[model samples]
Target: MRDPAMIETVAVIGLGTIGTGWVARFAAAGLAVRAFDPDAAQREALPEAIRQVLRDGGHGEAAEALRLSLHDTLEEAVSGADFIQENVPERQAIKADVLGRLDRAAPVDVIISTSTSGLMLGQFQEALSAPERTVVGHPFHPVYLMPLVEVVPGPRTAPEAADAAARFYERVGHVAVTLQKEAPGHLVNRLQAALWREAVACVEDGIASVEQVDKAVVNCLGPRWSVVGPHMAFHLGGGKGGLRHFVEQLGPGIQKRWNEFRTPDLAAMTDTLVRGVEEEAGGRDLNTLQRERDRKLSALLAHLAG
Candidate 1:
């Protein structure tokens, strides 16, 4: 594995939301970025998009110092790259094809990382000539701002390669959680999907409106989770006895609630969910809402850092 300081050049493929964020982050960390996308418009707009993301994440000087180059082809982008961050479409076939090309073109030791949110790393590794160099580095949306990244190594991945990827992410100020085993949705996304299922069920059952459900999380669980995870929160809820006492006293009720939780029929509830979200948006455009969310995220991160 190369030293983190030696990883000065990175390739960012697919200049969509995640790819753009990766370009900004790598450039902000003082690595030269070679970014590529099939869409000419996206390629043209890449610099400004990255600039906005860096500025929004409170890295205005990094934005100013960002060293980036746009490329027309994957081979061109990764020719001299020390690491490759692939953000192609989520489909297995597409990812596999792109990763295969990267494996054939990139330096033999260059770690190829995927930003796949749900797909298992094994699905893409099969097509790579150097599968041992591939790993999953799944990150949350607005990757430039989010600190959490799930690092999952494929069955064929080298331990050193995974370690190098994690070290690189940490060097760029992200919290890289190395998973012990591969699973669908990795770790954080699985947790998020669980909460989302319940939130959607509440709306589907008419027990709460979309806005109400969001408010519940923002006002309570969100702030608490920002400080401590669920298990610790429950441990605190146990008072003198901690988790054991809480479980003994509240186990049955919790079990009953879990049993009662329904799997929402998404097809049937689509109209309701759409209408509810429209109401919640209250005519705010996506760009406006995204900017506001990023601003607040920056503030929260600053507070947490302090």
Candidate 2:
């Protein structure tokens, strides 16, 4: 396999939000990007949209340094590309089909990564000719700013492929977390789902409003987690005795809390969530909200780095 650090050209399949973010990120990192999107309007708008996002994220120089080529066909996009980032729809069949085509069109050495939010690598690579070279490179939304990109490998995937992906992600200023085994929703999303289920349940139980819950998280848990993960935080909570003493003392209470946690009825909570979100949005357009989010994220990232 080629050295991932030497990868200079990338093919981004699907120019949706995630794909566009990948494009901007790679371009900002000084890689030539070949982008493909079936939707003509999306293809036309991507360059400017990406440029604006880059600027918003304080990567204005990357926007000027951006070397992007928009393509109409998949084959054209993958031609001579060293890496391929697939951001197609999350459906299993759709990913399988797209990945199969990518495997056929790209050279065997070119690493093909899927930006699936919560799908298994094996499901998509089952039919691929070169499954070993394919891995899941799931990045969080607003990929340009988010530092995390989960690197998951299928059962048949080569170890080198996953390692290379980790290296590549780190090269582009991301925290690459390589999983030892495959699981649905990978790691972060599963943790997020767990927390979200509780948050939804809190609202369902009339314990707190959506805004209240969000504020609580942002004010407390969010900053704490950012500084130190849950395990370490709890270790500190244990005081002088650390995790072992804390667990022994608090285990029963923790278990009780866990048992009380409910599986929320999402269908029932949909309207409630929509109304709450709309109220929180307060008539701000998506672009405005997104820009503000990116700006704040950038500032937070800088502070954390310091």
Top candidate on lDDT is 2
- Global local distance difference test of model 2: 0.90
The sequence of per-residue lDDT tens digits that candidate 2 reaches over residues 1-306 is 679889999999998889988998898898999999889998999989888877877788988887899999999999989999999888888888889899999999999999988778877666888999999899998898899999999997899999998899899899999999899889998999999999999999999988888889989999899889999998999999999889999999999999887799999899999888778888998879877887787889999999
**How much does candidate 1 score in TM-score?**
0.96
The per-residue C-alpha lDDT of model 1 at residue 193 equals 83
The list of candidate 2 runs beyond 4 A from truth reads none
TM values, all candidates: 0.96, 0.96
Clash pairs for candidate 2: none
Give the alpha carbon lDDT tens digit for every residue of 1-306 in model 1. 667658999999998889988888787787899988999999999898888777866679988998999998999999888999999999878888888899999877899999998888887676778899898999888888899988999898999888999999999889999998789989887888889999889887789999999989999999999999999999999999999999999989999999998788878888988898789899998888987888898899889999
Instruction: Point out where model 1 deviates above 4 Å.
Output: none
